[model samples]
Each structure stands twice: as C-alpha cells, then as structure tokens.
Target: MPPSLRVSQRRLRPGSRVAIVSPSFGAPGLFPHVHDLAMQRLQSELQLIPVEYSTTRQVGATPRERAADLNAAFSDASIEAIMATIGGDDQITVLPFLDSDMIAKNPKPFFGYSDNTNLLNYLWNLGISSYHGGSTMAHVARPGGLHPLSTSSLCAALFSGGDFELYPVSEFSEDEQNWNDAAWSDPNGPPPSPLQTSAGWHWHQPDRVITGPSWGGNLEILDWNLAANRWIRNNPADYSGCVLLLETSEEMPSAAYVFRTLRNAGERGLLAQFPAVLIARPKASNIEIQPTPEQRMQYRQEQREAILKAFAYYNPDTMIVFDVDFGHTDPQWILPYGGMITVNGPQRQIIAHFG
Candidate 1:
C-alpha cells in the first residue's frame, strides 16, 4: 500500500465517547468492581464516556461477538475512540469475524497492547492507525491508583496531536496487585509502590534521529501472527522506514526463546527492514515463576544479547533502545502504531508523533 493509503487521519479529542470493549479477555466485566472503576476514571479524569459492550464482560463469548463489539464501536458516530478492557491469549481468533470496511472507514483511535497486538496489527494492515497502550482493567484501573506515567502518557495519547516526547518515569512499579483484592474496590488503595529513581533511557547506535511510522507490539504475541500469517505484509520491504517497538509479556519467555524468535525474523528478512527498534522493559516476574535478582539480570542479558546478535546479522546499522517503559511494565508509555515516531538516538530521545 502507498504511504498515504496506509495512514489513518483521525485524532482523538476530549469529551470523545470512547467505547470499552473486550476483544480478547473479559476480565474487567467479570470483575465489575474494577471495570466500573476504570469507567469512572475515564469519565472523571478524561471527560470521556465509556460505553461497554456485551462481550466486554461475557467470558467465553465467541470471537464473532467480540468482533461485533469492535464493529459497533467504530460504526457508532458517538464513539470517537475505543479501548480494550484487557489483553488475552487468543485475540488471533477474532480475525475472521472483523469487518475491515467498518474499521477502515471509521479510523478512530484504538488503545491496547499484548494480545491486543493482534487487533492493532490488523488495523495497521487495513491502513488504520492505533495505539499500543492502556487497557481499562490492567493499567488504567489498577487496584492501587494508576501509575502517574501511565496516566500522563494515556492522556497525551488520547487528547494531543503532533510530536510528543516520552520521558522515563521517575518512579516505576511492576507489582501485580490482584483484582480480587477488596482494595481494588476502593478508588484509592494503599499508595502505589515508590518508583525507583530512573536511570534514564539506554541507547545503542546513537548517531542520528530516525523518523518513521511506528509498528510492533508484545513480542511473544507477534510470533503468533507470524505463525498465522495474518496481518504482516508479504514483502519485508513493506516495513521499511518503520520504527518497531516491541516488548515481552508477563509470561517472560525464556531468553533462548527470545533469541530464536529474533533469529527467525532475521531469517525472514524482517529485521533488516526497520530503521529503528524500541524494546520495552521485559516483565521480570510472574505469579508462577518469580526470578531472583540475579536470575532476572541474567534473563535480560541473554535477551539483549540475542537481540543484538539478530540485528548484527540482519541490520547492523539499525538504531535500538533497550528497556523503554511500555508493554507489561508499569508506567507504560502509549505508542501509536502506524503513526509517526522519532528516535533521536544521538540525543537519547524518543518522540511519538500522533494526531
């Protein structure tokens, strides 16, 4: 597709009636208390109405219903934007049920990450822009108050247009405060964990500012897309001039797996096409498999090495930034997929231009 044809032009505004749909999982609606809080925050903080759909709370609903909810949100003139309730493990299932025409025509902002990467990449394939951050249940309406950085970045993504810089949050949190906890019911729970002072963004190949349309999402979820051959362009060159932002989920795939995935991308000629890659900080802990500090550091090191090796093999000149705050980590930065991104590696700065 031509560059102009692949871009969506709508920009979100305040007072937009945003639809909250569960395209993947319905955790929010299943726990109405948390979902309701998210809705409340959307209204009070953003001055946006949150419209919920049937599938938003309906666990085990067919992908058809989820697709219908997406269609409804886009088709509704009143709904200026759409946000996912949370990510799931099977968003790929919803692909067949989607109405590409509706999504292409409406072209409003859609916000999600992780499994929602399925929909984001799908929209990108349809030549529509989308956001890769902020879900109702996970980030916006956490048990404790939302992270300041997450909230700030989300607001900027929803309301602002044009070039916007993303800074490292002074403090960050990755604590998985459970939704089942009564504290979630309280709009304000115990104070969020103190953010450790930021060490600032790390840059590699810091030479010049590379600007391009943004692409990529939860790294593990994207592998599913590769398997299905669903949303990616057939030609690797189709991704040329794009800035790829990737992150791992809470599942924390083994470092070997990360390297292997990158190796596969390199083999496919995908790694060499992008001008830059912004890798989000990997989630280091999970309920089932918590790693010690040493183990976590080792994991990060291995993954980093794997990424470097793949880049060296495929695109040695590509710019890269490690540990950007997006994806499964707290203080997530909202990124606009298919929208413009500026990576000023020489200046150690990143700007996501959305409108």
Candidate 2:
C-alpha cells in the first residue's frame, strides 16, 4: 500500500448514529451503569447517537453473531461509523466469518485496539483504514470517571480531519476503576494524578526522517497472527518503509519472553523492513502480580535492553521510541493503521499525519 493513500474522513453531524458492537468480548451491559454513562457522554458531548447490536452486550455469543453485527453496521446507511465495546481474547475466531467485499464497499471509520488488532489488520488488508485506540466499555465507560484526555483524543479521531499532532497527556490512570462500584455513578472521583516528567522520544539511527504507512498493534496479539497467518504479508519486504507500532498488554510477559518474540520476528526476516518502530508504554500492573515501583522500573529497563538486542542483531538501522502512551494504558493516543507516519530521528520527533 502506498504510504500516502488518503482515506476520506467522515464528517459526523449531530444525531449521527454510530454503531456499537462487540467484535471480541461483551462487557458493556455487564456494567450497565458505566456503559449508560458513556453512552450519555457520547450523545450529549459528541452529539452522536449510540446504536447497539443484539449480541453487543451478550457474553459468549458466537463469532458469527459478532461478524454479522459488524457487517450489519457497515451495511446500514444510517450508521456512519463503528466503535467496539472493548477488546477481548480470541477475536481471531471472527476472521473467517467477515465479508471483505462488504467492508470494502462500505468503508467507514472503525476504532478499537488490543484484540481488536485482528479486525484492524483485516480492514487494512481490505484496503480500508482503521483507528487503533479507545473503546467504549474500557476507556469511555470507566467506573470512576472518563479521562478528559481519552475523551479529547477519541473525539478528534471520530470527527476531525487534516494534520493533527499528538502529545503525551499530563495525567494518566491505569488502575481498574470499577464501573460496578456504587460510588462511580457519583460523577466525580479523586483528582487526576500528576503526570511524571517524560524522557521524550529516543532515536537509534539519527540521520534520517522515515515516512511510511503505519502498521502493527499489541505485540502479543501479533504473535497470534503469526500462527494464524491472517493478514500479514508473506514477504517481509512488502512491509518495507512502514512505521511499526507495538505495545505490551497487562499480561506483562517477562523480558525474556519479549526478546524471544522479537527473535521470532527476526527469524521471519520481519525486523529489517521497518525504518522506525514506536513502542507503546507497557502495562506493568495486574491483579495477579503487582510489582513495586523499583521492580516496575527494572522491568521496563530489561524490556528495553531486549528490544535493543534484537534490533541490533537483525535491523541495526531501525529507529525506536519507547513508552509512548498508547495500547493498554489510560489517556491513550489514537493511531491510524495504514496511515502516514513520519519519524524524524535526528530531531527526535514523531508525527502521525492522518487523513
């Protein structure tokens, strides 16, 4: 695909109906209180009506139902765009059921991340562009309150056009603030935490400005794609000049595991194709294993070394930026898959130029 192919942005007028579907897992009605609040915010704040599907709130529905809902949303002239409720495991199952022709004929903005990586890649393969950030149940329907940064980024993604610059949001929260909690409906929560000072974009080869159509998603999920051979190009050279964006999920795999995955990419001759890679901030905390501040910092450092080692062995010229606020983090920035991204390594600046 050409790095400069422009996907026309949809102008969302007031009362525009946006279909809400669960292509992965269903958690919206499970936490109806929070889901309803998010719906209200979308209608009132953004002036977009939320259109729900039958299986959208039903957990354990067949992948066919999920795929059907996706087709229905795209086919309906009344529905202008599609947004996922949240990400879940096993979205790969829905792949076989999707109609690529239908999606191609009715290309509209599709948004989600994590497991939704499967669908996003599928859309890209069909020559349609999709956004990789924010979900209804997870980001918009947080228990305590919606993050202002999340709302702002999502709005721009849904309604805006032209060149937009993304910066790190000042405050971020990754804790699981429950929508089921009674106190959450209070419309207020604790004050936003202060954002820590960031060590800005880091560069590897500082001589060039690489521009390409963006690709990639949650690192672990891409592993699953490798096994399934769903949307990946058979030849690594086909990905040449593309900016690769990656992130780790809350699963928090060990640094060794991360290295092994990178090694697999190298073995497949996939590492040398991209001129630049944007690493999303790893989600370090989980209910199963909560590490101390010192341990968390060590984890990030070790992961960084692993990435550097793999790059050195395979693609020494690839530029890298660590800990970008995307993927499984609060105040996540929206990224366009198969859209133009410019990485100026010498100046240490990264800019995503979307349609």
Going through the candidates in order, what is the number of backbone clashes in each? 1, 0
- Per-candidate TM equals 0.95, 0.93
- Residues 22-117, candidate 2: write the lDDT tens digits: 999887757666667678877877798999999888889899999999989989988988889888898999978988787788888888999999
> What TM-score, to 2 decimals, does candidate 2 have?
0.93
Instruction: Assess the local accuracy of residue 231 in candidate 2 as a C-alpha lDDT between 0 and 100.
Output: 85
List CA RMSD, all candidates. Answer: 1.8, 2.2
Least well predicted 10-residue stretch by lDDT in candidate 2 = 188-197
Q: Best TM-score goes to which candidate? A: 1
lDDT for residue 29 in candidate 2, whole number 0-100: 52
lDDT by candidate, in order shown: 0.81, 0.78
lDDT of 1 by residue, 121-169 (tens): 8888888878899888877786567777777778777776677788866
Best by lDDT: 1
Error of 2 at 137 (Å): 1.8
